[model samples]
Target: MQDTTQSDPNQQASTTPITGGEPRYKNILVIEDEHFIGELYMRALTKAGYNVKIIIDGPSGLKEAQTNAYDIILLDLMIPNMTGMELLKKLRDPNSTPNLKSKIIITTNLEQADEAKDEIEKQADGYIVKAEVTPKQLVRFLQSLER
Candidate 1:
């Protein structure tokens, strides 16, 4: 399988100001199983002036994503209880959770075929390989969504 672990150019061109005189905190939800990775993302996003919440499993994460409003969602593919793909489908369905308008970004370690990646990209706003980007870079990517 090809390693499609590169940042989107459009995302790289984002010039949104994450911090300024007053803190403009954008709410973010992170659905990751690994404690270390989730904490890393929380720290980086919090430092970048974003309100971040993390859920370790898919079921609770899906509930949180549905009940609350968030600017962005960082999702892991291979999560417990419910998979990220299942959550994505539910989140995308207007009838399932009508108020969920958060931009979903897949942040996973799983490798997939090119066709599968394309399908996932169509479903999600963005995709990132966990090993490919630093926390700081992830922040930049999230900032890009503001534009």
Candidate 2:
């Protein structure tokens, strides 16, 4: 067999592509179970011109979601209690958050495309698999909410 692929120095990566959009969120809520990833996202989103708040557990995240108003929420489906899916359902309820209007984005390590699609259909603005996305990608995702 012979090598036949073109070598382009400026070739783009095949990683997750971030879609750009307007500045919709001034404040964002990040609900992640993993402390490291939560911190990582907090730093990235903050640097992206969006104020962000981090919650490590699901219940606390739910409480915060109910009490405070944010432009968007970065949620993780797996948590100790009050799972992200439940959080999403609560957020979608008209009575759960009468004054809430934050767009929810599911962020997890799940590789299942069906799960991501299900979340989108359930009201998540977007989905990002943590292990599969970069910091810049997360930041750009925050930017996407602005649209």
Candidate 3:
């Protein structure tokens, strides 16, 4: 990535209740390769009062991220043509269009935390393991995104 960090890694995160108080984010962009997971996330996030858009492939994800104005971006590690890291790199580059300021997060199944550890050094707002996150937990996860 192009080094877009503005905060330290150990920053504290706060969570809000799920009983419909007020949403911290309105627009969310989910970039994943699996339609099943994308569909699930779409349903969950839309129910959470987010205007969610899903892109099922990496190239499409990149294109969508470039064109759509979003408040948050969810990325999956594995995708066709371009990996999540490459997509992030493209987003962080100054030469790209859209000039994204939407907070970014990665939801993936990759085990190589050391190899993936470099991402935390980048500007991702959050990271979650897909297998470990439940639907309800995902809702809470979105809540914590306000942090």
* 1 against 3, candidate with superior TM-score: 1
Candidate topping TM-score: 1
Q: Which stretches of candidate 3 lie over 4 Å from their true place?
A: 1-18
Residue 46 Cα positional deviation in candidate 3, in Å, after optimal superposition: 1.0
Using lDDT as the measure, what is the rank order of every candidate, best first?
A: 1, 3, 2
Per-residue lDDT for 79-117 in model 3, tens only?
A: 889888888777766687457888888889877467566
lDDT value for candidate 2? Answer: 0.77
- Model 2 agreement with the true structure over 1-147: per-residue lDDT tens digits: 665757577986434333432244678888887888888887877666678898878779878988988888888888777777788888888887788788888887866568657666668778878888898887866665543
Candidates arranged by TM-score, highest first: 1, 3, 2
TM-scores, in order shown?
0.83, 0.77, 0.81
lDDT by residue (1-147, candidate 1, tens digit) is: 676656687766435365452233389999999999999999998988889999989889988988899988899998999988888888888998799878899988879789879878888999999999999999888766665
The count of residue-pair clashes in candidate 3 stands at 0
Q: Judging by lDDT against the true structure, name the best candidate.
A: 1
Worst 10 residues of 3 by lDDT: 13-22
Q: Tell me how candidate 1 scores on lDDT.
A: 0.84
Clashes of each: 0, 2, 0
Residue 51, model 1: lDDT of 91
| Model 3, position 54: C-alpha lDDT score | 84
